[model samples]
Target: MQRPATTPLSDTAQATGITVTNLTKTFNTDSGLVTAVDNVSLHVPEGSFFTIVGPSGCGKTTILRMLAGLETPTSGTINVSTGSDKPVTNSMVFQGDSLFPWMNVWDNAAYGLKMRNAAKATIREQVGHYLNKTGLTKFAKAYPHQLSGGMRQRVSIARAFANDPDVFYMDEPFSALDEQNKTILQEELLRTWEESRKTVVFITHSVDEAVILGDEVMIMTARPGRVKKVIEVPFERPRSVLELRRQPEYGEIVYDIWASLKDEVVGAAL
Candidate 1:
């Protein structure tokens, strides 16, 4: 397949600082070609929190993997610009903590900085700053096995933020937590995003979570995933989850996206 031309972001769109153009991916199996993502194009403005949500096997994670450079796309382009002077850096937080078993919380959080040849002082400062922000300061000495699931996830979040990445790609980072823990982490994630002013691309199965966190939500089709629709979330920032839920438009948007998703999900199930 021929690669599509790069789509330039418009002046208005450039404010978000991330552009994904004609992004497609295919996998070759013994059975034949399997297209995971097809002709998907999206623009995420700088400092905006964008989200991709779909049912299982819809290629949401595949799209994120491609952006993280872990998976090569069969075609398309991902353009990310942090600023004029600095190179763009991206950090990913996966579903699992993936922390080293022997490493303490602080060490796990400092691992990236260590790899970058950062000074011990710099690593200490960055790790301390983010761990405090994520409320994991007390657990800084605890091992991954000693911490609760939520605490481990906090360590993951701190570690990602400690890298000072220009963009954050999260793949269901809070899906494993209990309801209360998930809600708390979600709020903390937003607070961190607000403070850092980094672009974010999050993947989730929950419509409520997507609506609560994303400035814009992109729905994907099942199996051979494709962009189904891009919906702008018009709610104001510093949002109150309770208040947002009560808004009439909230239910309307959820229903609209669900309607579009249901058939594809059903078809994939068959």
Candidate 2:
């Protein structure tokens, strides 16, 4: 079937970044070779907050791993521009905070910079900046066990941002939080993105989250994932989580994505 045409962003508003061509990934299982992603092709404009949403085990994480160069693709290419004078950095935030038990929050956030051999002065400044931005400055000296789950996740986000990555890949980072914490993190994430304007590829199962957070939402098929649809969110920038959710157009976009995925979701159940 012919996919719907993507709504083009204006040149002035477009982000300049990466393109994926005929991306496919498969894994060798005991039973047989299992295809996780199939011919998935998409472009993520520079500095745009793009998201991919699908059911569990639909290759969302597989795509992210490939982008991070953690996994090689069976066939396909991801083209990233190296035009920036500064080195390009990529950071990921997984479902768990992945903070070290022995390290305090400040230390954890500085780990990435430390790995890069950044100057002690630079590390201190960057760590302090992001911790303050994520509102975790007070808890900087606290260990992971000392903070709440939400605060731990905030540290994770702070760590990622501290590195000043070119692209940020988040896989269901807020899925574990309660409703209130999730909402707060959502707002914090937007604020971070606004200030940094890094290219982001987020994977989630929540349709509402996709609509609220994405510049474009790429909906995938049940398994052997493909780009079933790409829905643009034309709402004004710096949107509030509550206000955008209440918009009629937001509901329309959510329902449209649902209509496209309902059949695939049902098929997966069978």
Best by TM-score: 2
Per-residue lDDT, model 2, residue 10, is 37
Candidate number of the best lDDT: 2
Candidate 2 structure quality by residue, lDDT tens digits, 89-115: 689998776899899999999989999
lDDT of each: 0.85, 0.87
Give model 2's TM-score versus the native structure: 0.92
| Ten-residue region with minimum lDDT total, candidate 1 | 1-10
Give me the runs in candidate 2 sitting further than 4 Å from their true place. Answer: 1-15, 85-87
lDDT of 2 at 138: 93
